[model samples]
Target chain A: MLGVTLSRWTMSYFAAALAALLAGEVLMTAGYGFPSAPLRAPETLVVVHVVAIGWLSLLMCGALFQFVPVLIARPLHSNTLPLPALVLLLAGLGALLAGFLQLAGTLDPAPPLLPVAAMLLAGGFALALYDLARTLWPAQPLPLPARFVAVALFFLATTVTLGMLFSFALTTGLGSRPLLAVAGAGLPLHVVAGLGGWLTLAAIGVSYRLLAMFMLAPELEGTRSRAVFWTGTAGLALTVLGGVAALSLDAALAPALIGGSVLGVVALVLYGADIVHLYRARKRRIIELNSQMAVFAFAALAAAAALAVTLIVLGRLSEQVGALVFLIAFGWLTGLGLAKLYKIVAFLTWLECYGPALGRVATPRVQDLVVEARARTWFLLYYLAVASATVALLMAHVLAFRLAAGAMTLATLAIAAELIRARRLVDVSAEIRLPAGAQRPHLLMSVPHPSP
Target chain B: MTQDYLDLDVRPILRDGGEPFEKIMEAVAALAPDQGLRLYATFKPIPLFQVLGRQGFGYAAREIGGGDWEVLFSRADIPAETAPAATPASATPSAAGASDWPAPVQEMDNRELEPPEPMVRILAAIEEMRPGEVLSALLCREPMFLLPELEKRGHAWRGGFEPDGETYKITVRVGETGDKA
Candidate 1:
């Protein structure tokens, strides 16, 4: 009953984004950063954008395109926005990554391309936000999903604006301000908005409908989901605003800044609790590969949050290590998203083709799409690679970190392959179709009918 | 005669509807037989069952699958002493009019102005009506699929079921001027 239609294009954008990152990984492996690279290396920016814009952003946008309508029980205001959004974002992201790569080695004329690309990416995102907003306009008194979407929009705006500002500031050498004077000044804000607001909030909203609908669990009721929403939202807002102010040396507001973080922690905890509750009530005994593997991302967030809080309290939050947290959140959430998309695409394909023939003719079961057990192995390895990378970066083991990054790249490539297979890209329907003389049995029939 | 019963598969008989069920019911009555001929279908049209049962075709149903059911109907007056033939043993058969059978419960309840108690009363009213049967106070919410389901079942409601504040009520008048019935 939903009218979102951007999955195919979004997956393509996702694929392109991963390809760019894998290319960057190759560059880094070839002694590109051999001479004690700065913590905020340009190559790092390339990897960051690949994970952020390429994987997580693409996954989030595609999923929202497919899912938001179902959450609101309404269709998108217009179906045409996704195509342009996909094209503009992918092109802009490609340009921006190339600019970052060029800057990493030696400043080139391509530096000017950064702002241009950022503007295009921002414009694309703005259009998406507009389309989504208009569609959600008549949603009648706003549900919890709408609330989450609203917050995610705000974060999207902030992240894009901050990203653009950073892009411009990189060229102008606005090194007077302490935070701006630092190499990776706006990293924390970008991380907070992109990870906590955009990815986390959107994922939560999407999960509410998806998990319940597929598992046949009852609709979420009471104030718990709402509480999680408000807490996460308010916490992130405080954390972002406070961190920004503190960076600007607003020492008076530092306590409020800390308070905001504490609230964010509370929100994450509440969100974690809600997820557990959702799983408990689920009717589907077996959670498919996506959700089972996705829990690590959630765990990583909670764990990273605790570590961040400790570092903040101790007054020793390192910029480089904070970057690592960004990696974990982006990698894990995006990885889970890409993994889940494999199943969703397969399922939607089945529904589109076979659903009408349900009682009229025999159809394959949903399980026939892919072997879940094998997919589960890839997911486990992906998470393991992420954990190792996070630990290696924290300990400042440069060689181990690069090795772990390669493993991560390989794992992600495997995930992409699995998604391609799940979509049945190589499989023909004719191969699986029943022969002409075969008797097709009803799925709901208790007795299996013998072939006539 | 018993061999005749063994040779007949009851599937086509009940699938043939009223006349066939009646003929089978008649044969059961003449049998002084062991068991009744049971008619089973996924949909249990209550009127058909009531007609056959009242006319001496005994039937019982047990749900076998989520929405599938098995119905068993046997002769009502089979001898207490005789172990009825595993197959039909009737030598002679009579005809059962079975025409006085009440219409389907849905048809009987069409006369109500307000929601009727026991609800099935609404069906009774509809069945009794010559042309217009009023079915009132049947709750229908989010009726897109439901209205179509009713239509597919040959039920027509003018302006369909509407809610009375929190609860819904409707009058479904079968055999209206345009109705096929």
Candidate 2:
């Protein structure tokens, strides 16, 4: 079997991630974040962290738990550790949100909890990183996808470390100049490391493998893929360096940032081209719903990159940065995450339920587990709502943005419902009886069985 | 568990540009359940290994002098009372041992098929195979998703990319009680 075991807690992580996503979306819909509150407001920070750490980080971690083994062609080091890691992360996120509320004076009677949140989050991330690293350690000279994940893990550590420092600074009253500098100037660095390095780079790497596998296209293992990795890594490094330099009040920050942005754009462009090539060369002429919806996410990524660059060039980035971040977070990263989850959930459920029965009795194909016709509308609604929200943000139309956010929340809820249905085997035909000894899996929890 | 051997040589047929497959199958059909076959050919017959393997014949092949090949096809269900004196000079032994597996009963070329379809076809095909029967398939990519499922269903499989470095070939042995052989 080549030792590839299914990750038991991946569904649990996904459930938590989706809940966080819905929470973030609902918060925005209720006018908690910008365009309602100032971008720097603690209320906005609460929403941002809810989405970034709660939704995206959990989603990525869950996926990697399942896929890193596939990428390395090895079994996970430990399956028991993920549930505890998830528990720590959720608790940390809860504390972090509460701390933000305290900072906003909404919970003035509460003690300072940012440091506690930081410690918990750091511990959780550490455990995850250790488990993944142990799995990857033996498989030296990793494949391209695995390399991306390895690099992203480094950035994740850096992001968490920076966040911890910020939390401490804020809690300690930021009296020292260095602490003040880290608290004030390091926010952008944290964002770049977390969103760009940890999240986007990892997403790009994973997508390269997955898209090719699903499409049955030739994997991009040649010079182009190498170019993407090198450029993307170098760009993120330079940008992060610039942010560090800014904290130290260095004169080299501007040039470093500019150079980094240019390289990042080049990497993204190459990646976009590679995706197009995959679609063009795909053997499956009929594109599946997940792959089709991922196109909008890719477009959003390109648009966000272009818009950010244009704003930077015009020296108007600060003024419109809120809208740009909204596009990147909701339209690009979250969009891609949601789109892929639709297929991944179905695929995993099929493996769980039908795998044992395979070749022993009649079984439904993985495609049979998902009704694309029902999901297609929700996906369309999601992208449309995100677009309208982005437009409203650009126009500084607060009420319009809120309405769009409400629509986005609705679409996300509908998609989540579909994912749940897939997990429950609700979409599978009743006529195809499950083979003897093959039982339906739980929706959120994995039932223990003898190891294969 | 000793059985009488029926000797067949296809080298002369190949020298005259005649197809030997039909003659080979005819010999296979004529053999008693307790009998085995000794085959000689001008070159190593890789495809025939699977062809006969499906019929519950374990094989051991060795290269003879002057580019000729000698192969022994034995019934796998029978206990090996004695090891053949000639070591398997050229036969590639799979996980279950080369001489312990029968040829694939069902063969599929799933190169152009998409995800799940290839898996679906393979699983469905194996369900119809008799216990101890083997199936062979060719796929465009390594059947990553299919491998675990095969394990879960208690089937044994060996696969690798062909010499072309693109096409993947897999041989699966149906397990007793739908368990791994």
Candidate 3:
């Protein structure tokens, strides 16, 4: 298999998706769609969906497509799905953004376009889920991490279905007054399903494998890891379903929400402990910048939970809702993604370039592909900006928020530069002179680096 | 199958001069049409297995002791696709396949080992393998990373999950093409 590895296409799509995320952030920083903008405003919705669906989802999907093959030790059921999925997702995303723009009263040419957008987006998710399930179908007793992914996909389907129904309500001015009222009340459920059930659950599953692999620790197959899995699954299920009952049926499911949130927190706390333990038991004593910085992502998750729980306990849900979302998205999920991205890109690039001649030729280690100290500074600045932004949003300080956004934009640009360099194998192959008449195509074109 | 084959031990050359690929290849070029070769090594000879197999030879290995293995090689006058029971599993590793592969000169359970450890250990073991040795290893997953290394070094290998599906067992034979499927 000449330079063929799982999810190469998916990773390429991830690169493109990251660009879209950065663009959305830039637009938000420029005050195009932001905190000061009307709540649920179309432009703001555009930015949010772009980051949520376009960037983060694509990144996660690409990572999964690659890692699953490694986990199962077989090729994916179909390697060609990612390219088509990417196309569908982007097309759907563009349509959804246009629909949002139309809702903002900017483009009202079509009578009801949001439903079509929703259908396209649903189509994309359906394809991704089908491909993912098929890839995992043959495993007799699926691994813990794979099981988590499977459950998360179920939540994603539920979330998308509700989202599509809500889009129809918003666009077509649907029939029943009671249905509209329930849909309006149920909007937050969609948010929870997407962020909590889909994104957070999927991340936990992948992290279990990645942390153990990268840290050189024994696989955490103990009772505690199982605890994290069950608690998380049960918690997300109750929270979403309970929230639905309260919204649609106007029933008193407060206990369910409270109980579910508590379970969710328990899951996170256990997961955090597992992470720390894994780090302690690691055979590789020297930790790299990416894994080291990943600590902050974990901390941010705990902090976000604390704040959310406090808000719920105090009945101050409306006070700083926007800020809480910001911290989770930027400080936790995006932060973790960025940290992992640099490492993954370097690993894949190394495989692509140096893999063929690995035994025959002297090869550079994966760490040699990029300058860590250079990336370290950017990571620091990025986290600082996130922290500052988090504080400002918490305090309702407008000027501070804008300043932090500017800093984040700068830090993001720096990191993007480094990421691109890693992808291109910047300093790896340019200086190496191939022997005359050597026909080794990939190695000569440039190559992979080394790591665990 | 020949009852008696020429015995050639290259462990001494490997320990002294590193890889004895050229010396072994020279001996292969001198073999008769119906002749078979028995080689001894410190560890499974991974690279040599594929190298010799490419020349139309079937091989099996059996481990005699730690850091010691004996592999039997026979020319395939009929272009046999499958490797015959190499030495009748001098000692089989406890697994489902119930294969009669050569006894592993070195046995490693890499289930607890992480990525790159499995790769590194396998590479290091094979480097010390004399002609006709075999190495067996169990891992958490297939060492996809090691496959390219095996190809680069001219080795033959086969691996699959244990009946439990959690444990992946692999075998490497030097100077003989091992089973691919």
Best by TM-score: 2
Residue lDDT tens for model 2, A1-452: 37465688999999999999999999999999677999989999999999999999999999999899888778889888888899999999998988988888898735799989998999999999999999999999999999999999999998998898888887856666755776677777788899999999899989988898788888888899899999999999988866676666734456767888899999999998999999999877788999999999999999999998999989998889888999999989999999999999998888778666665566777888889999999999999999999999988999999999999999999999999989888888788735554578789966434233
Error of 3 at A409 (Å): 2.0
Local distance difference test, each candidate: 0.57, 0.84, 0.73
Candidate closest to the true structure, highest lDDT: 2
lDDT per residue for candidate 1 within B59-156, as digits (tens), equals: 55666565444555555443232212111212211121112322222322222121112122333333333454333333322222123223432445
lDDT by residue for model 1 (A287-340), tens: 666667666767777677777777777777765464445455545565557556
Which candidate has the highest DockQ of all? Answer: 2
- Tens digit of per-residue lDDT, candidate 3, span A174-201: 6876567557777777877888888888
In candidate 2, the residue pairs with backbone N, CA or C atoms under 3 Å apart (3 or more residues apart, or in different chains) clash, namely B53-B102, B53-B103, B54-B102, B54-B103, B54-B104, B154-B179, B154-B180
Q: After aligning candidate 3 to the native by TM-score, how far in Å is the CA of B154 from where it should be?
A: 8.7
Per-prediction DockQ comes to 0.04, 0.28, 0.14
Off by over 4 Å in 3: A1-4, A109-111, A175-181, A429-452, B1-99, B104-114, B120-133, B138-169, B174-181
Poorly placed runs, candidate 2 (over 4 Å)? A173-180, A249-252, A433-435, A448-452, B1-102, B130-132, B152-154, B176-181
Deviation from truth (RMSD, Å), model 2? 8.6
Ranking by DockQ: 2, 3, 1
